[model samples]
Target: MRLSMDLELQDIPGQLLLALQPLKDNKANIISVVHHRERKTPRGTIPVRFVVEMDRSKLDAVKSQLVSLGVTVVRAGEVRFIEDVAVVLVGHILDSDLGDTINRIDSTGYAEVMDLALTMPGVNEPSSAYLRIRATGKAEIHKALSILRQVGEEKKLLVIEPIEDEAA
Candidate 1:
């Protein structure tokens, strides 16, 4: 299962190590860690957010480990992203560099291509691609679509966005 865990740590060194070691020992694959060291909580602690892929059953053990290590686990049972958008590209997708297109979304760190289907009828023919993009929220979905629009314009492809998402 995928989880997004929020933790509070002291302003001392090695606090991040404390937050990470439990996930590591519990065999959790750390996906992303957002450590706002410059920002302090009301309790004068640092707020750290972690996204990991781990077994659901081992959640309690990880939490217990963190608590024992003096780390506060604020929230820990959320999936990575909450919003998704589907888009269609109609043009010479392969020749226009598909990998870079996907990377544009993934590199944003706020959105990613969760699914893709491409159809190429002939070597010189235009192809059609269907992509499912997942983002953290509605604003992020718009941000991703903006990037996609720019990419489509640069590649001279037709970008079909959902009508519900076109209310900008």
Candidate 2:
């Protein structure tokens, strides 16, 4: 399963590696790691987020190892973003308040824009944006797409959804 873990570690060198040692020892597949370097928690520890794919049975052992090594496990659970889709919008995306559009989908609490890329040709020209949205499930993904469709109509943008794979 895909699991996300929040950890607090000392600012000393090799702490990050030490925190990851348990995951390595348990044979978890590392997906992503985000280390907050400048932001230290009140406990004088740096916050690090990790996403990995590992068997359920190994999770507890990994946690025990981490705690024994002095790593603080703030949170650990299954990841929610399981369904993902790519979408495109072509129009005055920036002029229409891109942040609000993204917020509309994100405020649903089931979906979020994971990646975004925007391009504008000229000052008065329309712009295009590529959005990678991840949702908790297919139903949520559809809901997010519907919200985007409504936003597109209101903003006069062209929203394009990915074509379904018939074989899948």
Candidate 3:
């Protein structure tokens, strides 16, 4: 099972290592760690967030071990991202460097291509691609779309952003 854990650690040397030791001991595979060293809690402790995968049976042990090590587990549960925007790219998706197009949006740090569907009839024909981008916020979604538009223009592809109005 995948778990998202939010921890509070002291803002001092070896604090991070001390918090991670329980995860190591419990055999949880670390996926991503967003260490917010500059952000402090009400008590002036650093906030750290992690996405980890571990056996369901071992989760309880890990949580216990972490608490024993003086690490405050603020929250722990299944990891999930809330924001998603669907976009369509029409025209020469394959010929126009699709990988680069996707990478451009992902490199922004606030958005990522979470899902994609491609349709290509032939090598000499234009193709269409549908992508679902997960972003951190509403503003970031617009920024990601702007990046997509810029990339699409550079590659001669058409970008269709999702909206309620058809004529806008």
Per-residue lDDT, model 1, residue 23, is 90
Task: For model 3, give the 10-residue run with minimal summed lDDT.
Answer: 135-144
- Candidate 2, residue 98: lDDT: 91
TM-scores for the candidates: 0.60, 0.54, 0.62
What is the per-residue lDDT of model 2 for residues 37-151, given as tens digits with 9 covering 90 to 100?
6678988999887778899789899999999999999878786688999999999999899999999987665578999999999989988999999976665677789999999
By TM-score, the candidates rank as 3, 1, 2
Candidate 1 per-residue lDDT over residues 30-102, each given as its tens digit: 8667777767898999988777889999999999999998999888886668899999999989888999999
How does candidate 3 fare on TM-score? 0.62
- TM-score (C-alpha, index-matched) for candidate 1: 0.60
After superposition, the stretches of candidate 3 with alpha carbons farther than 4 Å from their true spots are: 86-122, 135-168
Best by TM-score: 3
Report every candidate's CA lDDT.
0.87, 0.87, 0.81
The CA lDDT at 145 in model 2 is: 94
